[model samples]
Target: MTPKQRRLARRLRQLRVNSGTSLEAAANHLGCKQPKITKIEVCQLGARPDEVRMLCELYGAGRATVESMVTLARTAKTRGWYQVYDESANPENIDFVELETDAVAVSNFEIDLIPGLLQTEDYARAVFKAGLPDISADIIDQRVELRIARRQRVLDGDLSVWAVVTEAALIRAVGGRDVHLAQLTRLLEVATLPNVQFQIIPTRAGEYMAMGVPFWCFRFDDNYGTVALDHLSGTTFLEEEGDVERYRLAFQHLCSTALSKQDSLALLRKYIKEEHSEWERRS
Candidate 1:
């Protein structure tokens, strides 16, 4: 289940508890089996919009909360846009995308490459090629398209993003000089968006916390959030309170140590100029 669905399940369970309604009572009120209520509460089953509305009425929930639950129910039943690439995409990756789509805010710390939501098409293609050298070209193309499609979230102005990227990520030429320069230019363009922010962690900031791996923290309107850790083998989603808090603090530290937004933009421009000079020399 996506984080949104899990959050909705938690809310449903909490509402029942607050109203002193037993599982049997809720099931009876909804005219469903007890196991059905349990499944819905645990996110094993999706609740219908009408069912959510009825439960809210039964629990005497406020208008805002009721509407929110109904919206979550509807969203839970809908398929994610990433489903189109289901054959090529990992299930966990699809789940992460679903959570990202519903997130109100996202915080990412990248050590190796730019986050998928911020990467340019060429840079993304290069990363995919390097990471999955054994994979078929057709599969890589599908992944690249999926990565590019994720950028629409920012373009639509529905999500706010704050990214802390390492200096090495900027310095490394993922798709040769011209492509790398273009990628930097793209970063500068997106950084100007009202909802997007970037911080560059210089090579000088050595031996810092969160240097071991890249991770993304997502925040929702319901105050529940999750952390996704990128590993060589696969991505791991962390939802435990302690794990999430640790990553959150690590991200905070990275932001504090990294360059300010203005300085980060300046740094990107510097890289672009250097790359352009190198490209000119080679040409």
Candidate 2:
């Protein structure tokens, strides 16, 4: 099993253990055998929404808190947004991806490249190459294929995206001519979709709560929200109310300073046209 699967298993175990509760005691709370609890804690089987709710209640989680976990379990089988990397990206913590995919709406405050969920295959590859210079060429190619496949996930889900992008991401040149053009084209196409709303926040707008923090905040049914923050090791999921609230406020502030959706699309078009013009001059 992968680290993610191990983590989910461990988290459930720790929640009980940390409460100074025994397996049998927790099992009684859920009206299940100790072995059943063990199976889920070992990631041997996926937990059902009702069972997950029982576990949360046994752990002393509040109604709002337990409801969130229930929703997570309910939507844990949804298709991943990173379908492009389906073959390459591991399916260890696939439950997390499923939760994001089923989210009714997503709010994002991005400082660099577009949010991964909003990226096209070409744009995703371009960004990946910039940081993963040591990755093998064959591996990079696979990664690109994965990202392209992932981009199509929005079409498969009842997903709505509200995004705020920093001006720097727009100006940065990545993946060379064809790649960048393709990326911009993809963005335009995505923007035209009925559920998507995107805007650009020029650096001149100044800073707010997201002055330096960038995260993908996904909102699900039953008021469940997950904020994934980039870190040195990997991604960290924030469940604490304070952390989630901070991200929500930061996103609101970023949106306050960003261009309106219509103007933002126009800006993207202008940027793309100018870049192509410059490419022709250089060629």
Candidate 3:
């Protein structure tokens, strides 16, 4: 099922239960069979906007809630924005992008690289080149374009972002010193946005919780959350309550151990200068 459909399905089911309604009753109200209602709630069948509105009304949802669910139901039937990059994008990455579209906020922890949503075009291109050397340049270009589009949401203030990175990641010259410095400068600029927050874990911090793991927690206003763990193989999304909670807690701990927002920006400036100086010296 699509992300929006899944979200709508889950919320519809919850609303039914909260209203003390049974599947049989819901089906009867819709003049359908129980299996049909079950399929709608399971996302095996799409829910029409009228159906969603009716269901929400039956579930005692307010006018606003009904309209919201109805809108989601309508959008769930449309194509996702990332469909254009299907040929070049990883399946896992596409899935993450789909889910990210509906996310109200994102909290990401990076162990050795800048978070994807905060990366500059050059930095992201360098990363794709280094990580996926087997792919063609055309494919890499497509991926880079996709990354830039994803990054735009953060810039447009459509999505709030909280990012935590290790000092090592900031120090590593991913795309050479010039690209690294540019990336750092971009980070400082992005950090100034009210919707974006950045924290850095200094190398001196030593050991901490989830020491070697990196993950992203996406929170939605619908009371659902997802944690994405990116690996060499693919990205794994955890939606179960326990798994999401664990990652959420881990991110909180990481934030607490990392430098404050102001300090992080200060450290980022320091690195930009150091990288620029090193580049000039070698030149």
Predicted structure with the largest lDDT when compared to the true one? 3
Candidate 2 ranges with C-alpha deviation above 4 Å: 1-87, 90-98
TM-scores for the candidates: 0.85, 0.71, 0.90
TM-score winner: 3
TM-score of 1: 0.85
At residue 118, candidate 2 shows an lDDT of 73
Please write out the lDDT profile of model 1 over residues 1-283, one tens digit for every residue. Answer: 6666777887788789889999999999999899999999888998889999999889988888788789988887566677898999888878888888878999999886877889998899999999889999999999999888889989778899999999998888889987888888998899889999999999987878877678999987766678998777888888755677788899999999999999999998998888888889999
lDDT of 2 by residue, 155-253 (tens): 665678887888777777777788777777778888778778889987777765666777778776545466877654556777554677778887887
- Per-residue lDDT of candidate 3, residues 111-158 (tens digit): 889999999999999999999989999999999999999988999999
- Quote the RMSD, in angstroms, for model 2: 5.6
lDDT for each of the candidates?
0.86, 0.71, 0.89
Candidate 2 collision pairs? 83-150, 84-146, 84-149, 84-150, 85-146
List the candidates ranked by lDDT, beginning with the highest. 3, 1, 2
Q: Rate residue 114 of model 2 by lDDT.
A: 75
